[model samples]
Target: MHAITIPEPGGPEALVWAEVPDPVLAEGEVLVEVAASAVNRADLLQRQGYYDPPRGASPYPGLECSGRIAALGPGVAGWSVGDEVCALLSGGGYAEKVAVPAGQLLPLPEGVDAVTAAGLPEVACTVWSNVFMIAHLRPGDTLLVHGGASGIGTMAIQLAKAAGARVAVTAGSAEKLERCRELGADILINYHEQDFVQELRRATDGAGADVILDIIGAKYLDRNVKALAVNGRLAIIGLQGGIKGELNLNALLSKRGAVTATSLRARPEAEKASIVAAVREHVWPLVAAGRVRPVVDRTVPMRDAAEAHRAMEAGGHVGKILLVP
Candidate 1:
């Protein structure tokens, strides 16, 4: 199988396309002939030797893919050969063939193609787990999202709105903020010029946001706490800023706010399976009904993953970047 492998970690240029041993399916896994993969910020970190795949995971950069089942491992059921599916992979999505846990597989949402479906897993799981499962965003709650133009951001805005939450987002530019607004964001903040804490408070009439989804970790830590309403929940999913920062405990305590963090890639198979199931039951219906959709900014060939990484680094894309395999 042809794969994009980092022989030795360096930069996007380190992603070398070469023939490698085909992945073998394990118990409760399925062999997927990958149709497409999508780029995430974490892929860049993995390529640069910062993020290592968990034990027994594929040593490739991709975290999600859309493909067909070429074969199934022992105990697999409710699916068969040639089933069209998109799956959240531990890694190895950069390859033509990846062995994915059957439990993590989801049927391509109605009206979506393989390439577009490739962009679904990471964002879907990230938004569902963080916004719904962790923060418990309910109808009428005010939800704030950082990196509102990102793949996760777009998906989060849509999901939160569909669930009846009032969505607010922060991005770097007016164009990106407009895009978020189009996706149902009620309040938009240009982070480059506006203070998110102040804007969020003003947007909510000094009540602050009920739930805040953050990607810039250390840089936003203090202000995020200050921007929370009473009993608000802050879920940090990325550290685009520095990882270490001081937090004002007094602010959190005063607001009775809670802070939590997680990475989808680091979860156990069973945990991921549960999230997938929940997404299938709840989120998949929204996509099927066209109330939500994958936001793809561009599509690049699998061999041009280096270009995708470069594009993401340049920060010009408004949504997900797909890699056709």
Candidate 2:
């Protein structure tokens, strides 16, 4: 088998595709012959040596993939060899073959091709778990997402809109904002030129956002608080803006707001299974019904993953980028 390995992480150039020993499946796991895997921001961090895989996970950068089952491990049932599936992975999706826990395997949604399904798992689980399950965003609420052109951001916009919430997004460019609009975002703020706090407030008649899906972490924490409505929920899934920041407890207390930080990759198996189950039950239907669709910016050959990483770091793509093995 061949997988992308970082002998010493440094840059996109560090993602070297080379032959490696095949993964040996453990009990309750299955071997998947990888078809495609998607690039993520976490993959960028891993490539740069900032993030490492959890203990016992594959030493590969990818976190989600679509593939066919080659074999099932002990205790695995209800799925068969040769079944087409997409899975959320702790790591190792960058390879031609990966071993996945049975609980993480998801049936490809009806009407979605296998290649495109590669882009769904991470974004779907991340957005659904954080925004809907954790924050409890409901109909008529206003949801704001930062980095609106990102894979997570694009998924968040569509899912929130489909759930009857008014969606707002902050993107860096007009083109990205226009794409967000096309995905049902009701308010689009060009973060390079405008204040999202003021823009979202004005859009909601000063009620502010009922829920905020934030990625910029520290740099946006203070402003995110200002942008929240009373009793609002802010879910932080990324710290791209740096890790340290001061919090104004008084402001949050005044609004009765809540702030939560979570990561899908570091979650326990049972918790991940629960989130995957929720996604299959909820978000998959929206996708099967054509209410939501996979947004892929482009696909690159698995051998050229370095190129894909470069594209992600360039911050030019509007959605997920797939790596076909």
Candidate 3:
């Protein structure tokens, strides 16, 4: 099996595709013959030596993959060999084959192909867990998604809208915001040209957002609190702007808002399985019905993952970047 390996973390150039021994499946796990994988911002952090795979996880960078099942391990059931599926993984999706916990596997949504399914698991699970499961975004609620043009942001926009919530998104450019609007975002704010807090407040007649899916972390913490509606929920999933931030507790208190930060990769297997199940029950139907769909920026060869990383760092792509094995 050939997987992307990092001999020494530095830049995209550090990712090396090398022949590695096949993964050994454990109890309740299955071996998947990888069809494709998708790039995430976490992969960039891993390649730069800032993030390491969880203990006992695959050392490769990918956190999700789509492939056919080659073999199922002991205690695994309800799925068979040759089953076309996508899975949420802690690591090792950037390989020819990967071992996945059976619970984390999901059948490809109807009308979606293997390559497209590769981009579905991470974003789908992320949005479903944070926006619907945790924050409990209700119908008629206004949900604001930061980094609206990125993989998770795109999915968040569609899912929130599908659930009868109004969607708002912040993107770096007008073109990206336009793309978000096409995906059902009701309000699009160009972060480069506008203040998201003011823009969102104005769009909602100063009621502010009922929920905020934020990725910029500390840079937007204070403003995010200020931009929340009464009893609003804020789910912070990324720290792109740095880890530490000063929060106005008084402001959050006044609004009675809630804040939560979570990471999907470091969770226990059972927790991941639960999230996958929720996604299959709630999101898969929407995707299969074509009310929601995968948004792919482009596909690159697995061996050339560095190119994908460069493109992501360049910050021009609109959605998930697929890596075909």
Candidate 4:
């Protein structure tokens, strides 16, 4: 099988297209013939030699893909060969075929094409787990999502809004903010021109946001706590700004707030299975009902994986960037 891989980590230019060994299905796993895969910030880190796939996982960089089941492993039941599905992968999605644990596979929503379904799994699982599962965002609560036009951010805004929460988002430009607004964001802050904390406070009538989905960690940590409402919950899912920061414990205590940081990729298979199960139960219905849809910025070929990395690093996207395998 031909896969996109990094010979030596550096720039997107380092990604090479070449033949690699096809993945062998293991117990509870399924072999998927890849149709498409999506680009992620984690892929950028992996390409730069900063992030490594988990032990016994594929060395390839892709994190999510949509495909058809070509084969099923021992003990995998209820799904047949040729099932149209999209799956969350540990790695190896940037190839013609990928082996995924059965628990991580999601049936493609009715009416969604395979190429678009490829963009759903990672953002769906990531946003659903963080915003709803971990942070406990509830009806009438307010959520402040950083990077509103991002793949995860767009999904977060829609999900939070659909759940009857007021959604606020911060993007770098007016155009992106407008897009977030169209996606159901109630408050739009152009982070380049406005201070997010101040804007959030003002938008929430000085109460601050009840829940915050943050990608910037260190640089925004202190101010994030300051911008949090009483009893607020903050879920940190990325470290784009930096890792280390001075957090004011006093602010957290004053607001009676808490912060939870996590990543879906590093979780044990059982935990991911739980997340997938929850998503299938709760969020998948929204997709089926047409209340949620995959938002793709563009689709590129798998061989141009380097270009996808560069686009993500340069922030030249409003939604998911996909690669057709």
Candidate 5:
């Protein structure tokens, strides 16, 4: 099998596609013949030597993929060889074939193709688990998502809207915000010029957002707390803006706000299975109903994953950038 490997982490140029040994399936895992994979910020961090794959995970950078099942490992059931599936992976999506835990697999949605489905798993599970399951965003609630034009942000906008929540997004430009608006975003703040905290508060008549899906971590922590409505929930999923910041406990206390931070890659397999199951039950039907869909910026060949990484770093894409194998 051929896969993207990093001989030495540096930049996008570090992603090297070369022949590698095929992955041997572990118990409760399956072999997936890769069709497509998606670029993510984590992939960029991995390529730059800032993030390493979890212990025992694949060395490759990709975290999600869509492919057909080639074979299953012991203890795996309810799926078969030749099944068309998209899966959440700990690593190794940027490859010809990958070994995936059966519990992380999701059947392709009714109207989505293999390439497009490649972008769904990570964003779907990330948003659903944080916004719905943990934060308990309800109908009439408002969700403010940073990096609104991103894969996770785009998915968060749609899912929040589908659940009858008002969606607000912070993007770098008007065009990207327009794209987010088309996806049901109600309040748009151009972070380059506007203050999201003030804008969000104004949009909600000073009530602020009921939930915030934050990707910019510490750089936005103070404002994220300020942007919250009473009892609001802030789910932090990325640290693109650096890792440490002082939190205003008094401000958080005044609002009775709660904060949670999580990463899917290092979670236990059983926890991932639970999230996948919840997504299949709650989100798959939304796709089938045409109420939710993937937002892909473009597709690049698997060998040219470096190009995809460049696009993500450029921060101009409106959604997921895919890599076809």
Candidate 6:
């Protein structure tokens, strides 16, 4: 087997595709022959030595992939060898083959092919867990998403709108904002030129956002609190803006707001299974009905993962980038 390995964390150049030993299947796990995997911001961080894969996880950098089952491990049932599936992985999606927990596997949504399905798992689970499950965003509420052109941002916009919420997004460029609009975002703010807090308040008649999905963690924390409506929920899933920031407890108390931060890669298997189950039940239907779709910017060959990482860091893509093996 061959996988992307980082002998020394540095840059995109550090992602070296090389031969490695095949993964041994543990009980309740399955071996998947990777068709494709999606690049994520976390992958970049891992390459730079800022983020490490959880204990016992694959050293590779990918968190989601689409592939066919090659074999099933002990105690695995209901799924069979040769099943076409997409899975939420803890790590190792960059490889030609990966071992996945049975609970993390999902049947490819109807009408979606293997290559594109590679882009779905991480964004779907991240957005669904943060926006719908944790924040409990409901119909008629206004939800705001930062980095609106990103994989998670694009997914969040469509899912919130599909659930009957008014969706708002902050992107860095006009082109990205236009794409967000095409995905059902009701309000689009060019963060490079405008204040999202002001723009969102004006868009909602000064009512503010009922829920905010944020990736720019510490840098946006104070402003995010200011942008929230009373009793609002803010879910932080990434810390691209740095990890340390001060919180104004008085402001939060006055608004009765809540802030939560989580990482899908670090979650326990049972918790991930629960989230995956909910996504299959709730999100797959929307996808199958053509209400939501995977937004892929482009696909790069697996051997050129370094190029994919460069593209992500350039911040020019409007959606997910797939690495096909």
lDDT tens readout by residue for model 5, 29-70: 999999999998889999999889999999998999999999
* CA-lDDT, candidates in order: 0.94, 0.95, 0.96, 0.92, 0.95, 0.95
Give the per-residue Cα lDDT of candidate 2 at 89.
99
lDDT by residue for model 4 (1-325), tens: 9999889999989899999988998999999999999999898899899999999999998999999999999999989999999999888888999999999999998879999999989999999999899899999999999999999999999889889999999999888988898889999998889999999988888999999999999999998999999999999999999999998998899999999999899999999999988888888898888888888988899999888888888896999999997
What C-alpha lDDT, on a 0 to 100 scale, does residue 227 get in candidate 3? 89
TM-score of 4: 0.99
Prediction 5 TM-score vs. true: 0.99
Pairs of residues at least 3 apart in sequence or in different chains that clash in candidate 5: none
- TM-scores for candidates 1 onward, in order: 0.99, 0.99, 0.99, 0.99, 0.99, 0.99
Clashes of each: 0, 0, 0, 0, 0, 0
Instruction: Give lDDT tens digits, candidate 6, residues 259-290.
Output: 99999999999999999999999999999999
Give the CA lDDT, 0 to 100, for residue 279 in model 6: 98
Model 1 ranges with Cα > 4 A deviation: none
| Deviation (Å) of 126 in candidate 1 | 0.7
Which lDDT tens digits does candidate 3 get at residues 269-314?
9999999999999999999999999999999999999999999999
Looking at candidate 6, the ten consecutive residues that score lowest on lDDT are: 200-209
Ten residues in a row with the worst lDDT in model 4?
Answer: 307-316
Pairs with backbone N, CA or C atoms under 3 Å apart (clashes), candidate 1 = none
The stretch of ten residues in a row with the least summed lDDT in candidate 5 is: 307-316
Positional deviation of residue 64's Cα in model 1 after best superposition, in angstroms? 0.4
lDDT of 3 at 287: 97
Alpha-carbon shift of residue 312 in model 4 (angstroms): 1.3
